[model samples]
Target: MNLTSVDELFETDASREDKQREKVLDIPLSKISDFPNHPFKVKADEAMLEMADSVKQYGILVPGLVRTKADGGYEMVAGHRRKKASEIAGKESMPCIVRELNDDEAIVAMVDSNLQRESILPSEKALAYKMKLEAMKRQAGRPSKEDNYSQLGNNFSTKTSSDELAVQTGESKNQIFRYIRLTELIPPILEMVDEKQIAFNPAVEISYLTENEQTELLETMKQEENTPSLSQAQRLKKFSQEGRLSTDVIYSILTEEKPNQKEKFNIRRDRIDQYFPKNYNEKQKEDLIVQLLESWYKKRQREQER
Candidate 1:
């Protein structure tokens, strides 16, 4: 009866089982659910189609990460793209690394994983950062005076949740705050920001307006066929804060000429090409025009001096 050898054998078996838990398992697609409120979009564009083709040929090389739910189904934490590709590739099951993560942990992990993507929409980052920041704050427990100040006012002190998020995402703390501000905007205005019709700084300022004011501003913009400049948006934000912003005020501000605005002159490409040699490209023509302008200016100066 060698009890020492039996104990050693049991220990070895336990280690093997632990290692097995870390290995990939073929999870039924029906058993896996998408992460709740997943901010990232999986578009079925050319790239996705190419990915599906690759998956069909070689199978999924990287295993997806998932956690078991109470009802025994799995919830995907990462690899949303892979999951979709697998489905397109006609896979009944996907290879997954089963993990155990709580709500806050899952949120942080999900944000961290998706933020590495090459092309993320602005709205996605805004919502993801907001989710991660809230999760971080919850993990850290009760709100401090610093949280109150950051939420109520523009000033952010040392190492706020936004600051920590900035560190994680490689964005400036101010930029993170600006992105979060976008969440307050009406959906149409926010969508305009995502579409790049409204610039980031102007959109940030516009986010401070109330919903009714934002709708009014949108109408004014549509009527004028113009978006706000940074300075104009700042003025709008100021007016909104003071409760003085109205449709009339927005229209007036938008209609006012900007100090540095220039009247644009248009010349047809054919009209410009006739003045230059046949071999001259657009850049060469532009250089020649600039040279002629400079020469004319110098000649005028000489005549005035004489």
Candidate 2:
């Protein structure tokens, strides 16, 4: 009978559970590097502090996933947050599940794991989707459309990668494409989208502008203290495509008052209270005022007709 070592037996058992053949290994924190272009942020916020406390009290309950690098170090595949927390907890080494994965496979796994987080920024999703889409296309051995997007013209029909991405991510095909469109936006504009300062539809339209045009638009927005409406953004995109967009043109479009952009009127509560009942609430006072205005307008119209 052949005697198997305990480590070997554990490895054999772990391999049987997964087709990928993952093995838990204690890796030094210094040897593990971050995944290139990892879209998810690892902030040392309250949650991270809590996780660090947990790690200090009980060690890392879950093992991180990592792959061997060409230079002999390990690249983190998942659990970046866990790694950071472990470092904070004064841990020299962390338990990791080692796996061999190619670039496309790693990208897919990394994206899938991070997407499960509760909160993801818009810019993070945009860049992550773009990376995964490119990886998927590469894996399929299909040439990317980005290299000759303008040369292929607007009538091209290559959405296989996007469709696959949509299926994987639970987003609509059109929405996936829209998020990918955000990759063309400059960082400042993209950050605005993440901050909710810019709406999604308008941001998509703005992404079509050339870099110079986008810079000018950013300046115009800052000067005017306003963001583009969907219609205005579309007009800017159309003008850019036509090669007629300029700083002056952007200024003109931005200066145009939108139909819904009405000036607000404010009234002091103390000033209006004398005109209403002492017991009347704010809503009652507003309704009574509106009724009186309607009656006054009707009386004036009747007099004018007489």
Candidate 3:
């Protein structure tokens, strides 16, 4: 019942077919317990109210989905608002389509339902993609090109049973791969991707970047207008390969494909350090401390501003 626990969300009990067809007739809302949404889509109050008005006027166009309760009540799946609106309208019994989905099925169903609205969070998409991939792996023992993922109990992978998930989803292999890459990005940038502040291709390009590089580009991205470019990605690769890339270079590559950036730090170990103790804090300690403090200050500043 808490959105913070992904484990709990994915571990819910599924619905059974016989239970789905058990014919729980016009169950009164009062009799059926209210199920609060952990990950709710209730933000658009005007919209929910509008939908409620529609439900009140013409009745629930799409039957609310529910699951059978052991105590002779029902738990909601989809259409929480419709159930709520119907109850608000003082209806004794509300129409519903009862289904019993397992934990995984429930997660998939909840994700799919949320996807119907304006936009789904990138974090949600990442989890959904991961769920499907795991489910596909379970079904076929691997991501084989032959099996139809759709036929499986849960098609969590981007593609159906067949390896043609790209075709089925109407996305390019690159795009699909890019979406999967979003899974690798840490939360903040992923949130940025969900906000539509960052475009898909550029974000994917950034995902391939290393943590340091990603952190670097993310800092630059805040000050700059658009996200990094393909050219920027390539440049980053080149710099990283050249073994001289810095946070500045990361920003430069992302913002301008220009090689105006230079490595910010260079460590030159003295030829005599071999005789010192491995655990010793030598004369270099003071300088190293200053550098560490500078980095910490910058990080703290970013955190505060954020």
Candidate 4:
């Protein structure tokens, strides 16, 4: 006859209890704290307002995840937006599944859950990737009994935590590194990247500038009303590394027309203003000219295709 060992029976009982404790519970919003240094922004934009209305009518379809804090109350691992929606709906609590997770584990879970969102801004991705990568490195440092394996579940074949993250997130290691570099950018300049006023490649290149240099560049951009092109950003970075990126140098570079601008049709505003209505402002006239040129270019392209 086969007999179950005492340790086996005890382990089974513990596992069953753990599963039972995993059920959803109504956690008071007041008792739940946001995750430490949560990188994702919780905006009350149209999507969130719509979610609140749905929640007010139908209630949350999915529960959030949280874990007990050492001091008191629970810390959110995921579902910050749902919590916000619940608040907007005038609810006292939201449903959440409490879990047992250490700091590193929670960081990984929080980042993974938020990364699944349909729309994430570049600054959001930048901070999230940086946080997750750092957490992965910390987890990797813990000694493992298995050969060449980390607590993060990465095989040493991947070489580093960044490489492991690249494999999981489907971003090249270099690309991941570039995103991480964005965390170093000053807030105003970083916001420009998020707003798409500064293109991604140029923004990443600008991230290398010293904080003071970046601040100077921001002032220069405002004065010139022009952002850097990739070529100009490269030149700035080169000068920065050589310790010669002065405020005057920044102005000199920014005031210079970009390479793309060099090929643009040039006409004095007054020369074209006579073709527009007398009341039309400079901006209106310039915009009309651009629209007309775009239409002409598209028509030419279609003719060439034919």
lDDT per residue as tens, model 2, 4-48? 889666786556666565679999999999999898889899999
Of candidate 4, the 10-residue stretch with the lowest lDDT total is 143-152
Please provide, for model 1 over 7-91, each residue's C-alpha lDDT reduced to its tens digit, 9 standing for 90 to 100.
Answer: 5666777786876677689999889999999988888999999999999999999898999899889999999999999999999
What order do candidates take by TM-score, descending? 4, 1, 2, 3
lDDT of 4 by residue, 1-306 (tens): 999889767787768787667789998999999999999999999999999999999998999999999999999999999999999999999999999999999999999999999999999999998788878878989333322211123335537777778889998776777887788889999999999999998888898899999999999886556899988998999999999999999999887866557544446555665689989875787789889999999999999999
Q: CA lDDT of 10 in candidate 2?
A: 72
User: Compared with the true structure, what per-residue lDDT tens digits does model 3 show for residues 55-160?
Assistant: 6788766666677777787777666667767766656778777778664465456545655666556655555555554554455556443332221223345544
lDDT of 2: 0.86
lDDT of each: 0.84, 0.86, 0.61, 0.86
Clashes of 1: 0
> How much RMSD separates candidate 4 from the native structure?
9.6
| Candidate 4 segments exceeding 4 Å error | 1-21, 142-158, 262-306
Q: What TM-score does model 4 achieve against the real structure? A: 0.77
Comparing 3 with 4 on lDDT, the higher-scoring candidate is 4
Candidate 1: Cα lDDT at 176: 77
Instruction: Give TM per candidate.
Output: 0.75, 0.74, 0.53, 0.77
Q: How does model 4 fare in lDDT? A: 0.86
